[model samples]
Target: MPIGKLYGIGVGPGDPELLTVKAARLIDETDIIFAPQSKSGKPSVALNIVQDYVDKRDIPCEIYQPLFPMTEDKEELQRSWDEATDVLYEKLEQGKSAVFVTLGDPTVFSTFSYISSRLQNKGVEVELVPGITSFTACAARAGVQLTEQDDIMVVVPQVSEKLTKILPYVDTVVAMKTSRHLDVLEDCINQDPRQKDIVSVQNCTMDDENIVHGFVDNKKYFSTSIIKFRK
Candidate 1:
């Protein structure tokens, strides 16, 4: 039997309704669904966003929660990716189509990207269904424009010393996963003499979402900061 196709579906930021029509249709048709959890016992946010669709499927759909730990260690991360790939490959080898749900766009800083690359190398067909990104959702919720005519925007995965070099070249900067690096972000922004406006949003589009005009010492994992420098 030919290997079953694999899908990487982006479930959007936090709202269930934000799932694209294509993503919802695949969720209902797939034989198995895989979602990544940062820890063993914690619920997968991506799975939660699509639970209703999964529950409404006429045929029973299997769900798999693989642990993808949040760490910077390359070796540990590679091991985890390999294990997850093995699990998916076994299912695909049996001709079972699978869907992997991820927060935001699957191609943007998502664990699904790593898994998809491995599966593709193993001859499994891969398809991606794009969804709204968190930073765009945050900007909408906070009523901030990302960019205007001829303006440049840069998206940073983490706030770091490199931001100082980036600030002078872009009209807008979206710093994602800002919870752990708020101090470093503040320092970078302070160094720039240009007048700037900052908006910090936590848990964008979720029920408990918070949007602040200026930076705060936020430690929420889903926090994002949008910095706009005056021209």
Candidate 2:
């Protein structure tokens, strides 16, 4: 039996066409595909991105729906991950090649990192393919440069409370996961000394995408706010 291998494939932002040739090929060729589901039992965005390439007739598909409203409880998170890994481990033990699809880039703020790490520590063969990130997609959709001249760019998750201090130094700031902190973010950027213009993009590169400028209402989730200081 061939030693089972794991593929951490990035399906890009939202557009199915944004799938890399390698990603598309893997989805087509891999014997098994694993997609993570957020609670509510909905299909994962990651899976949706590469659904067209997947041959439902020939391959075994596993939908591992994660417990909804991911909590800060370490014990609970660990328990859930262990259970999820068991499912993958069973496939690997059978020498089944399994591919886990992730949205945007696999490396940036992806839960795949934790899963891959646990698998590798147990001696599973693993490979990663890069995908388009929300920052780049949002920036392009907004038609703004991430950085220019001698200015620096900072990418931060919306969880950080340090946005106040960081605002003074960077030329551009991309704040991800802004849904939880939308109010704080709006107040911070609007009050910046540079008076940075803001662009908020949700589900970038996908149909039904939402983009807005200036003093946005605090409802949209899965968003990135771009603050451009280069006037």
Candidate 3:
């Protein structure tokens, strides 16, 4: 029997229209859908993004959201990954192709990349299809270009000294997962004369999405900041 292929499909940030034509087609044709949820039974954001594109009338597809927890504990993370891999492996063994929906481009801070590597090691053929990233979407929506001319751009997933070090040398800084380290980020950017250029966008392109002009004490979980420097 022929084996099935696994596609790590990037579902973009949130809006359904941002989905690539290829990503939409695969969702419609795949035998099963895999989405990464923060908890065991929570709905996956990536899965929701492609709902309009999936067709189940003639060909019904199963949707499975395996838990990919948000934690710093290594043992817990490994266990979650292992469990998710086992589920995918089972589908592959049944000759059922799958679409693993991801929030942004699969290569950048996406759990799909780690899971895809595991599936490959298990001998399952995997393909990655790119989609729009959140930063670019936020920039376009806010009318703020990420970079221009010879402007330097940096994308950081978390708060760290690296961001501070680069503050003096870049034109744009996109800080993801910024809620926890708001203080560190605030102090660094506060030192810059271009502090007014910073803006935090929560939920990017989603219907309930919001864009704040500057730093705030409370921020939503799915927030990221775009800071434009003087070039």
Best-fitting candidate, measured by TM-score?
1
Off by over 4 Å in 2: 56-69
Each candidate's TM vs. the true structure?
0.97, 0.90, 0.94
After superposing candidate 3, which stretches have Cα over 4 Å from the reference?
A: 55-57, 193-196
CA lDDT, every model vs. true structure: 0.92, 0.79, 0.85
TM-score of candidate 2 to 2 decimals: 0.90
Candidate closer to the true structure by lDDT (higher is better), 1 or 3: 1
lDDT of 1: 0.92
Checking candidate 2 for backbone clashes, the offending pairs are none
Report the Cα lDDT for residue 66, model 3. 90
lDDT (Cα, tens digit) per residue for candidate 1, span 1-231: 999999999999999999999999999999999999999899999999999999899999889999899898999899999999999999999999999999999988888889999999999999999999999999999999999999999899877667677679989999888887877878887888999999999999999999999986857999999999998
Tell me the number of clashing residue pairs for each predicted model: 0, 0, 0
Q: Is candidate 2 or 3 superior in TM-score?
A: 3
**1-231 in candidate 2: lDDT tens per residue?**
756999998888888877888887777777778887765567777877777677443755655555423567888778777776888888888888888888888899888888899999889999998988888988888787888878888888873567778778778888887877777777777777675677888878877788888545655657888888856
lDDT of 3 by residue, 79-127 (tens): 9999999988998899989989999899889988789899899889999
- Candidate 2: how many backbone clashes? 0
RMSD of each: 1.0, 2.1, 1.5
